[model samples]
Structures are given as structure tokens and as C-alpha cells.
Target: MYKLSIKKIIRLAAVTLITCSLFSCMSDKSEQSKSFSVQITDKPLTFCNPITLDFGTDRARRAGEAVVAIHQDDYYLFITGLRGYWYSGNMRDWTYVDAPDIPGGCPSVASDGERLIVSGDKSRRDVYASADPKSGVWEKVGYYDREYGDADMFIDDDGRYYMYWGWSQILPFQVVELDPDNGFKEKGKPVTLFFGDYKSHGFERRRPEDVIFSIFSYRDYLPEENPWIEGPWMVKHNGKYYLQYAAIGLELSTYSHGIYVADNPMGPFKYSPHNPLTFKTTGFMVGAGHGSTFHDKNGQLWTIVMIPSFYGGRGSGELALFPTAVDAEGVMHSNTEFGDYPQYYPGIKENAVANNFTGWMLLSNKKYVEVSSTLEGYGPEKAVDEYFLTHWCAATGDPGEYMKVDLGKICDIYAVQVNFDRHDAKLEMGRGFRMPPSLSQYQSYTVEVSGDNENWSMLIDKSNNTVDNRHDYTELAKPVKARYVKLTNVFTHDEGKFAVKDFRIFGNPDVAKFTKVKDIMVVRDPDDPCKAKLLWQPVDGADGYVVRYGIQPDKLYNDYLVYDDYTLDIHSLNRDQEYYFEVEAFDSGTDYFHEKTRQTMGIGAEIELFRDREMLARKMIVEGKNEYVFENIIPGTYQLRHTFGPNMWVGDLTKEQLIGSDNQVTLSEKISDLGVGTKVLGQLNIKVIPGKENGKFVVTLNYDKP
Candidate 1:
């Protein structure tokens, strides 16, 4: 009986031990799963079917340049160049609002959450305000004559309203404070922003004597002149104001648009180092200028500009909308194509507060670091600079995540560094982040800093690595006084888990001086034999040189010539005739242009014709839709030729077999030639299948000419 009782006790003990072990295993799995988790609820919002409004016939008298704005969920459009008319919509359709009883021929419009402000010329410069959209009543509260031209209004985050407009006929820009309650009144004296002479501003390019003075042609004293600044518009975002305006000059072919930026709405605005933010339709005779910018309901920013189909003619332009993104310097840049919406990565949400603070996410290492105050335990203390891993159960390999950090409080950062480590113990063959799949492997990493977490700046970027484990660093001169920092890995292999150790922010400040030019040289009409070679002294520290010369100082000159070498050869000139020339130097780091040198030259003789006809034939075959064959009877190593455009051709057919002794060869049928006059070569045609959420199109080009 004692032996049997001992056996029963032993059996019970074993069973209890087994149950406890099972429970421990289950709990461990649960904790691991939670650590490597992701939530898709934070994805960026997608918008489609943009609401478009036609004010009138494309060239109708009443149809003119228009500006669009969004308040709350309502879309308001202010069309000018007409007497005055407004339009309203709600993301779907637009309803025309009759012009208020105001007398503005070319009016500009803006909104400040409570009222819509329109400023333009009635009898003189005037400002009108309306609270309700349905009501057509507009009351004039302010007026300025000589101090304003084509005015625009902007309300900043601090509840301060500002108005930016052109000053005198010579000076093109001025800014003033506006009191919403008392209308937009002059808070202070108008500040003259940009002023320059007509020739320096590219106004009278061909004939200085035939200079045309319109509202668009004004003297802007700003440093750069690709497009002459006019028609000022302002928008404030994340504590910065962006001024988008029309730059009318012969350099940009007249009536083009560009952007400038300033910390405050008042004086001292700087043109974007990357100016001419957006290029209009190339040869469609489209003139893009006089635009306004606003944010949509989803917080996406868009710019509506007048891209008139009639350029160099006598008609108004149509209004087209383009998406824009702000950089670390608060400068705005538009995307390459129109109608292309900005894409948001998954696992990132707009206006999300982590630890009660709002910010945007920057992705890196297939993991996301939630760097916001809204996150639990996120504070000045107890904040761990570590990686937040995410699971890839639903997708192949490992998925990535993004987190936003507020940088308003932190300023003067020297360097930002990130360290990464793999998760698995044994190294796997395919283990890394991929950038766009076509490439073979991940090669580099880059770090960017931003003040508002919206506009990002590249602090350090490095590529071409041979080692599996390596450390990279980048030194920044401008110790970023930013609110956000993003680190990205440009690796495209198989996605796997990686670990980031810590982010180190240091303080180092070192600034560099801008370069200036000394002298320049130009060779006029070298090919025509009638032109002369012009020369000038080189500026110290200049990265490159630009030479501007033409037959007449004002019109039909060749495009500005850019060269890394000190000298330039201009091929546009008439023999025995004097031609004007100007040379400028550009600093590569800052992209600042030095003072220009002017000179004159005369053409003396003509040169021999050395046309690459064989190269031209190959270019033509590449550009034609149907397969082309070259047939001839010559057999003594004659050159095969192809022409893509009038002065452009492909040469040296030795790289690939052209044809047999019969001099006949058929081009590939699959090759797509975009026909003659198409500037875009080797473009990929993508057809979006209805209802498909994601797809990619890739195009490649090969050169057979040697």
C-alpha cells in the first residue's frame, strides 16, 4: 500500500511540471510578437479626382488667370485678369460665384480661416473682404495706389496677417502687415524687395530699345535672374513662409514662375538656390506664371498657377495645379509631372501625436523609431535612442516603419549619426533593405535633418561599399537648428530585420565664404567663321563658368553656355558685325553667381562642314516607329548613319553590326520610337489597370553607337 501511494504522488508531480513549462513557452512567444509589431492605421491619406473648374472659354474675355485656396473642407477659387469673379467647390464640383462689386482687373485672393481677402486694382489698389461664400457683398477696408501691384495675402501661425505686392514700376515687391479686423492696412512702411535694370533682368534680350513694360516686367534687385520676379504670393507652413511668384524675362522665354523663401513675411527674402522650381510644358506654347499655393483637407500642399496655352500671343492662360514639397531650408519644389499626387509610405500618419507631440516619420533599417512626445514615456528624460522593430508576418521578409520627432526645441546640432546591426546570429546571403528592386544590392545610407519634420535636409550621404560591416560619417557645416532628423539606408537585397543602436547629435559650427568672379572670355560664332573668340580673367574659387552672348544684346542670342573650364566658345554671331557678350562664374557649393563681365566681338570667317551623316541615319532609325533599313551599293567600309533630330545624331556604327555587304538591316520591331520632335527619349508607357492599388513601370535604354 505504501509503494502504490508513492507512485501516485510521483505521477502528479510530473504532470504539474509539464503544464508549467507549456505556459512559460506561450508567454515568451506573446512578448516577442508584441515587440516586433506594426499598425497600418497610420498610413498616409490618398487623394484622387481633383476638382477642376473652367471659368469660361480658354480665351474668352472674362476668362483670366485664377488662384485656388482651401479653408476647412471648402475649395475657393479667385479668378483675376477679369473684372472679378469667384468659384466655390467641395472636392467634387465647382459653382461659379459672381464677381463682387469691386473694381479689380487683375485681383489676387487668399483666406485666413474667417474671411476671404481679395487685393487688386479697381480704380486704384484696393483690398476687399467677405465672410460668407454665398454672399457676393465685398466691403473695401483698405487702399494703396503707388505702393502696391498685384497683391497677395498670407496669414501666419501667430495670427499675424501679411500682404506681399509689387512696389513701383522699377521695384517689383513689397510686404505689409494686415489687421483682419480693420482690413489689410499698412502696419509699417512698404519695403522694396527686388530692383534691377531691364538688360540685367533679361527683359530686353534681343532689342533693348524695344523694351516692353507690362505689369510683369519690373526691376527686382534680388541676386538671381533666370526668371524676373513679379506677381508675389505667400504661404506660411510650420513656422516658415514661402513666396511663389511669376518671373517674366527673355532668359526663361518670358512669363515663367519661380519661388523664394523667408523666415518672416516681411523683408529680406532669398531666391531658392534651386530656383525655377517647376518647368512648364516645353513646346506646347504654355506660359506658367502668376500662381498661388494652399493646402488640401488631407494636409497636402498644391500650387495653382496660370499655364496659359497661349504664349507670346494675345490670350490669357489656363489654371493648372501641381503638388509641391518643402525642403530643409523652407524652399518649395514641385514634382516633375503634373497630376502626379504625392505618395505616403505605409505605417506613417499625418498629424499624429506620439507622446502628446505631433511630427512626421522618416524610415530606415526596416524599423521605425517613434520619436514623438505622444509615445508613452517619451520625455527629455527616460527617452531611449534605440530602434523600434516591426514584424513582417503579412508581407515577404521584414517590413519597415516610420516615426516623427519634434525638433523645435533642439537647435544647433553638429552631426547626426545612426548605427545598424543585423538580428540573426549567422549571416544570411540575402539580408538588407532594398531601394527600388532593379538594383542588385544595397550600397549606401543618408541622413537628413528638418526643422518642422516636413522639410528635410541632407546632412550626410555615402555610397559604394565593399565590406558587409562598416561605419560612415558626414560632417555638416550648418549645425542644424532643426526639430527632426531622418536616417535612411539605400539597400536593396532581401528585406530582413536590422537593429539600430543610438543616434548621436553633436555641436560644431563652421561657415564658408561665397566666391566672386574676376574676368571671362567668349568665342563668338566659331562655327560660322564670322564670329570671334572672346576671353576674360577667371574668378577665384569658381566651380564653373557661364557665358551669355548673342547677335543682338537683347534677342536671338544662344542659350547661356555653362562650362567647368574657364573659357567658352560662342557659335552665334554675324561676320564683320559687332556682337555683345557677358560672362559669369558660379560657386558649386553655394551656387552663387559672381559679378558678370561684358564685352564685344566680331565674326571673321566660316568653317568647313563636318556633318556626321552616318550617325544621323542611326539616330533616325532609333527615333522612327517602324523598323528602318539602310540600303546601298557601296562596300568599302562606308559609315552607317541615323539622325534623331536636326543637329543631333548617333555616330560610329562599329559598336554593333549595321547590315551585310548588301547594306541592308532591319531594326527591331519591338523598339518604340516616339516619332520626330519628341524631346523625351526612351519613355516607358504605363497603363493603370482600374482598381489596382500598386504597380511599377520600368524602362531601359541601350546605346549601340560607338
Candidate 2:
């Protein structure tokens, strides 16, 4: 007979086991109780799925080198590297093409209907020839000795070929024209375009002579004033000449592009009031010069240019293609990555724009007034006053105070109104005033628009007017269009401080919307108990879902392990262990909007015990309450030996001896202790530690009674 110990009973009753944290139990009585070995599953963390495209044979050959152009139908790829030139079919299949005999290293390639032109560095400055695209053969037609390198070529509708080559070795704005018949002929000597002595000309100091031909002051040659102008590319669209070039330096931080309108290819040009068309963003850097323009098969205008990639060592650059759009006024606008190509990937969140004023301050004295929108109470107030100013101020003069807003889509704006307070007491009649004073002191403010925050338009002197003493509201009108708006102080008195409550603009709305997620579930595989399936419901209007999970609950929301499908299979899961998961929805129209779901946790089934393995035990002595305990007996029928109280275990003797309210017993017929098939109680041990302090203790107890 078997008996139970009071201590063991009390410990078992006190322990409240959580299924997810407990061990599994296996038993042989039921087929469903069979145990299977389990192992932990490894999940990957990444949102860039299909991140790598396998071009069968076209593996990237070298670091900083990539196949930029792929023409599968033509069986050719225009490959460019840091130092070499090659052509490949199907990317994987390659044949090295002889490097163009050029002096410089960074080469750019373009083609006319008649021949291919490779421009950059050494050998032939303007090398050209009608070579077989397949055989990699070049029949050198002509080499312009003076147009030595770093040149771009374009063919107009009139079948005229034009080349814009930089010639800074002579003068600042040296542009030589190349005629298909005579090559590069000097039309005019290099012209000095920009004023270099001004303190505002710091960006032009380190400009590369090889890339920048000249820097022209926009204010000198055009109706609308602009500062720096460089990196020129001439394109004829709808019979209008558009000279698109870089406005600032070639570096990522200060780089930007602009377009000038001209009727003649080589004559005077007018800087579009909408200059500096392309600006920088968090994901994109270096929006500068040395770019080319092209039209696709659909006649849509696109700019193929080089943009820097942070993945490259610092200061390194990469080439990118951006779609360009022009407004009715002929001003070109390049949309931000989030605004134009939002659906490039899944699980990517848009960076929030802050409207703090601490950084936008322009002060002659350190005692400037604190004029911020948040301090004056405004809706949608995530903007905070940061200690540091905009980085643009490091190079150019103060960019005036400004706010960054997510306009949602690509649109045009014509006018803007600002609410501000004058804070500086020592104010010059013509010079801009310093800051820090009461809001009531601000009498008037000025507003401007710029594709780039570094360069801005002059104040709308006509639009400048006084507002009420209670709250100042000023409207600035100049009939200008822009994607971004900036406001500055034009006139002030008595060291007054001004807070910009908000800037109202007249333009089209471009807002992005997000999709929503509904539900998620997990279940065991119907055909295989060793496997499990994770499933989720699709979000309304969502293009797909980004699902992520991990062993630790905290790591699940780290924006990793993104899956676009509705279900995933769990090949191996640890038994009696918990797992956590998270899901997010992605919209097809905009890549920035994502809705995340709450985290969920689940546990696997428990383990069971079998009788076949337990029957082999050698010891059969009952070790509990002596009143109900029994000694070993032969395998057979026996008379009633004893009776036990509730929660007691009986052993040996006849089957009747094991009968009790809460008693369990096993009868073994074989002589050697308990036979192999006999049932026995298993032991479970647990250790508890003090939650707040360092302490340890142990307790041991037997399972069944003797």
C-alpha cells in the first residue's frame, strides 16, 4: 500500500502552477498523450523583404560598384564602378569593357542615336564613337582636347547634340559648346558669374573645379533674387529651354538643384523664382549639382542624378533617379521620398516634423526674446524649443525662423500669413531686429518661400502691415508658389518678442492616410502536432501586413522580422513555453503610414508521462503515512490490507486496498519490486526567491506514501 505525507500534500496544494511556465507530462494510457521532442525556432529581424534581387549571374563585383542600368531584352547592362567599366548580359553574365581613356576617375555615361559618349577623368575629355553595343567595340570618332572630362551630353528634338562641360581651370563660369562636326570650340572665354568676396559666399570656397563650371548670383541676372548657382544641364522641353543645375555645393548637407528658363541654348537665362527645386530629407542626402535629365518612354520627365548613400563610407555618394514635376509657372518641384515614393517598402514609418522655435532665433545679443508657437498655445503642438539651431545656419546666414510641416502630398502654394511678436529693443530702421519681448510689442512680420531653407526670397514689402495690439496677424503676398514656407521679421520696435501661432497657406492639400489592423491568432497544425501556424486578419484598405515575433516580449516591437503574408508556420516550438507577437498594417498609396497592433502571448501544450517506462523502477517501498503504507508483494490478487485518509496513496496488496476518497494505489504482480508497467507518482521541485532582496532557501519532499 502507498500513503501520502502531510508535508508533501500541503506543498502541492500551495503551489499555483501557471501552464505556460510548467513542464509537460507524458502518459502511455492515451494515444494523444504521446510526447514529441521540441526545439526553439529562430526568427529573422528585417523589413526589407525580397531585399536582394538575384540577377542569376550578376553578383556585385566590387564594393562601391553596382550595375546601374539593366536592359534584359537587349541583353546588356550599363555597369559603372569606382574605377572600372564593364557590360553584362542578364547581370550575372559579364564581359569587361575597356575603360575609356580618361584622366578623371568618376565617369558618367550617356548615349546619342549614333554613338556612346563616356565622360569623366583622363584620356579623351569628350570621347565618342559608334560602337557595337554587344561587341564592346568603340570606333573613336573624335576627342575634344580642351573638353577634357566631366561632361554631360544630350540630344534635342531637332537632332542637335549639345554638351555642357565644366572648364573652371580658366574662369569661374566656363562652358564650351561641342559641335558634332568640329568637336568642342570656344564660343566665349570663361565668364565670372558669382561674386566670391561676400561673407555669404562661404559655400563656394571648396567647390570642385572639375564639377562646378561657375557660380552665378541669381540676384544679378534674374527678376527674382537668388545667391549661388552652379551645376548646369540644358534641356529643351515643349520648345522651352530649361537649364537645371545645382545651387549649393556638391556635399549632401548643402546640396540642392534649380532650373533657369532661357529661350536660347547659350544666351541669357532667367532664374525661376522656384529655384533650388530639390531639397534634402532624413533618408536622402546631397541634393546637389552634376546631374542629368531624361524623359522615359511615357514622356514623363525624370532626373537621373547622383545622391549620396550613408551606407557608403562617410562622404561617399550614390546615383538615384527622381521624377520631376513643373508647375504652370515653369517652376520645377522634386517631391520628398515620403511624398512621392511612399510604397517603396513595408513597415517604414515617416519621421515626424518638429515646429520648435528655439533653433530659429536670430539674435545680435544673447538676451534675445523666446518667441515660440508652443508657448503661445497652438493646435497640433508637438513642436518643442531645442537648444541647437538648424544646421543650415552653420554655412549660410540665419535661415530665419521656420517650421516643418507634413503637407501629405505634392502640391503648390501661392501665399502665406504669419502671426509673430517683436522682441528686440535695439532695432535698426532698415536692418532686421533682434528678439525677446512681450507678444503685444510685435507690430508686424515678413514672410518668404524657398525650395531650400538655406536660400530665401526677399520680404514682401507691400504685404507688410500692422495688426491689432491684442494679437498681431500679418499677411505676406508676393504671388509666389512653394512646397515649404518660412517667415522672418522685417520691421520691429522696442525690443519686443513675437510668437508665431501658425502660418496659414493657400495651396492644395497633400495628406497621407494609414491602414488599420484587426486580429491575429495562433494554432497547432492539423496534420502535425510538432508544428504550429500563426495567422492574422487583413486590415481594411491595407496593401499588406508587417508581422514580427520573438522569444522575449520586449523585443517583439523592435520593428524587425516583417512578413507581408497573412500566415506563418512555426516548425518547432518549445513545449510549455510562452511566445509574444506584434503586427502592423501598410498602405499601398503611402509607405509612411503604418498602424501597429497590441502584443499577444501564447503557450504550447504540456508534456505527459507513460506507464511503460515507470514499471522498470527497482524500488517499490511506500514511504508516507505508516497507517496506510504497505510492503512489496507478488504480482497477483490479494486481500484488503489497509485504508487511508483523503489525499493518501496506497501501494501493493489487492485492488480494494487502493480505494479511498482521494487515494491512489498501484498493485505489482512481479516479484522484483514494482513491475515495469506499474503506475508511480512523479516528483516536481520548485525554488522561489525573494522578489526585492537577495535570499535563498530550499525544501524537499517525497511524492507517494509508503
Candidate 2 TM-score, C-alpha based:
0.36
For all predicted structures, in order, the TM-scores are 0.39, 0.36
Q: State in Å the error of residue 247, model 2.
A: 4.0
Q: Least lDDT summed over 10 consecutive residues: which range in candidate 2?
A: 9-18
Q: Which segments of model 2 are wrong by more than 4 Å?
A: 1-110, 122-126, 147-149, 159-161, 167-171, 183-230, 284-289, 311-313, 337-706
Which candidate number maximizes lDDT?
A: 1
Best by TM-score: 1
Deviation (Å) of 154 in candidate 1: 2.2
Residue-level lDDT of model 1, residues 1-706, one tens digit each, is: 0000001010000000000111111111110111212222321222111112332212122223456676545676666544344443332234545554655555667776777777776356677777864456777766653445666777777788777776233566777776666545567667766652333223212232212222244663343432245667787766666777675532232344566677777858765544445443221123345667666554545555654322111223344444554533344554322121112211122211111011111112111234212222222111122211111111111222222333324455644434333333133322112112233333245567787657787776644433232112222444456656664545423343333333333331222222324454444443454435656676765534444343343321122323335554432233434555555553322222221121012111111112242321232222112122232222123332122223212222231233333323322222233322434334312111111221111122332321
Report, for all candidates in order, the number of backbone clashes.
46, 57
Error of 1 at 426 (Å): 82
